[model samples]
Target: MAKTKNPTLYLTELDVTRLEGIASRAGTAELDEMLDALLERAAIVTPDQIPKDVITMNSRVICALEGDAEPREWTLAYPDDADLAAGKLSVLSPIGQALLGARAGKTVDYRLPNGTAQRVTIVEIVFQPEASGQFTL
Candidate 1:
């Protein structure tokens, strides 16, 4: 049997440049490595070149997580803007990392706080800033 290939990760040039700076000052090897892994594999492109379906920074998406009966809306945000109550997920978070470059209908794997694996299905991309021409946000 052929092994399944994961979806390609796409990142805007702007986001990648900024992420590089963040990774440098992450203060922990784990966090730095996580960001590095994502960056290394991503196909970086200009903001206008990114597909609308791709999740960029500040994109709002509806997610259906395994074991959760109701789908929830989450906006991927930087750490400063993260608010679990409002569903503003931080990119530094494990789940957020999983969803970063995944497209709608893709099921992504992330580690739960307890260190167990969990899957999150991206049900829909409600809004992507770059898709709507709101680049640089």
Candidate 2:
């Protein structure tokens, strides 16, 4: 895989700490790579410094799959909180990693395990924990 410039990703200190632990224990090469990529590109910040428009854990976001007009909504969440039927996306998923720290109006690109490049655009942060004063979440 070629190392390319990734979109600037901002992550809260809490999120970074938690994710680091998760990454350290990752069992699969694919998961490890994705976690490492997320950590490498993240710009750690305080909870209060997280942008209201950025997609953080527990943030419900609306996005568009590149080339698709219909928008899909999902809540970026921890592995334990993820339930696809509920629209809760796990940070372990390729799409979830790509969306982390992405702000509304920005486009992020990530490659699938099969090496297929996918682009997703953040349309809106419908509900961000920090924006709602729930920073601990």
Among all candidates shown, the one with the greatest lDDT = 1
* Per-model TM against the reference: 0.90, 0.86
lDDT of 1 by residue, 1-137 (tens): 11114427888888877777777776789877888788666777789988888888899999998999999999998887999899999998999999887788889898977999999999999999998889999
| Candidate 2, pairs of clashing residues | none
Local accuracy of candidate 2 as per-residue lDDT tens digits, 25-117: 766786677767776777777888887888998899999998887999999989988999999999888899888888899998888889999
Q: Which candidate is the best by TM-score?
A: 1
lDDT (0-100) at residue 71 of candidate 1?
99
Q: Clashes in model 1: which pairs?
A: none
Q: Write down the worst ten-residue block by lDDT for model 2.
A: 1-10
